[model samples]
Target: MPNRTDLEALPDIPMDDDGPVFREPWEAQAFAMTLELHQQGRFSWPEWARYLHQEIDKAKQSGDPDLGDTYYQHWLAALENICVDKKITSGEALAERKEAWDRAARSTPHGEPIELDRAIRRGEFDK
Candidate 1:
């Protein structure tokens, strides 16, 4: 298992590193939302961290140690894994949601929410 420093040192993700040198505003927003939910007891921080470390370890064993380049992807992937582990959603549910979204997007009002990503955010596809 990783120590406190190793886990705490994870880089800012979901940002274009070429210009900004750090996470962009929306990138920060998404990260914050996830962290906020975790802090609110929607999910355990230890569990989330464990999933991330597992994924990171898999990446390391698979021959990539330069995790800085894939931080957000790893984070997102680990989050998905945790959601699935916790039975929050499933692949079949997401496929159905996507179909529902396709139909909804065509006829729904302009202010209506997007479904696919929303489902993920709401843990609807976690199983």
Candidate 2:
């Protein structure tokens, strides 16, 4: 829901004539999710920018090249940080959900939609 002016204000983001440029589908999805959250008043653009900059800085400290390819990974990390900071979700809850999704994706047939199985629904991740 971010307009051109809003997107333009964020210098860290790479954009093209059509819009933001993403190397993968998840990158695009993360970008869209952040923009949608802003639109819904979850956070202001400046606040989002601050969190994103922090994530990028952390990655750089860890020897990331700040290359365009890893841009969205930082974006996703920032989004997660804000979600936790705002009390929308906890880190532990997110980890559990990620484990469930990983299990579902692993068992799903190629090209089929992934869904949680009985074990996942029952919070059974041991297997």
Candidate 3:
């Protein structure tokens, strides 16, 4: 994983005295995933930066407030784009996974773990 100095070098991402701030657990997860992927040589920091900047710009063009809170949302968007660009996964596959997650989330009780159903686990979405 990239060290603190490495992360601090990036001016685009928000980092305070305590390091990066995330509005939700998933936001932190996404941020960590990005770093992990970069460390694995899936993408370079510069490439990730370019994609993140582009995503933020696109969101701004679409009237996103560009508020600090939505930083992770843009980050996730860029991550998804990079994944697709690298041919790691297809857009349709992501959409299907998202839909499956939504279904799982909706079906589970509040505060319960949302588990993918058997169909989703069986790669039914790819069918």
Candidate 4:
């Protein structure tokens, strides 16, 4: 995991004195996942930074405005890309999982947490 100095060196992270600030639950989740992956030695900090920069650049090329709101979207993209590149997970698996989550979210009532296991038990993942 990156130290405070390393994290501070990165550009445009929404942070407070308390550390990284997230506007939504999934943003924090993505941030935590990256930290855990790093701690597991899945990739070095430099490698993660490079992938994140690439994702940001790619988003810009596709006309994504340099708005603050999309920051975590880029972060998530970098995570997925790096995971696939490192063979930690395949693109197909990610896509399937994303679909499963979407189905779970749809089935969940408002204000309720979406659970993938429930979706699976409901045979939502049956192909």
- The candidate that achieves the highest TM-score relative to the unseen native structure: 2
Q: How does residue 25 of candidate 3 score in lDDT? A: 95
What digit string (tens of lDDT, one per residue) describes model 1 on residues 1-127?
A: 3334433545433234332233445454545555766766767766777777787778778887754766666676677676667676666665677676787677677897745455544674343
Screening candidate 2 with a backbone cut-off below 3 angstroms (N, C-alpha, C), the clashing residue pairs are none
Flag regions of model 2 displaced more than 4 Å. Answer: 122-127
Runs off by more than 4 Å, candidate 3: 9-11, 123-127
| Location of the lowest summed lDDT over 10 successive residues in candidate 2 | 118-127
lDDT of 3 by residue, 97-125 (tens): 89889989999999988899986668686
40-83, model 2: which lDDT tens digit per residue?
Answer: 89899989988988999999999998877788888999999999
* Pairs that clash in candidate 1: 84-126, 89-125, 89-126, 89-127, 90-127
Off by over 4 Å in 4: 109-113, 117-127
What lDDT does candidate 2 reach at residue 3?
A: 82
lDDT of each: 0.61, 0.85, 0.85, 0.86
> Model 4's lDDT to the true fold?
0.86
Preferred candidate (TM-score higher): 1 or 4: 4
lDDT of 2 at 16: 86
Candidate rank order under lDDT: 4, 2, 3, 1
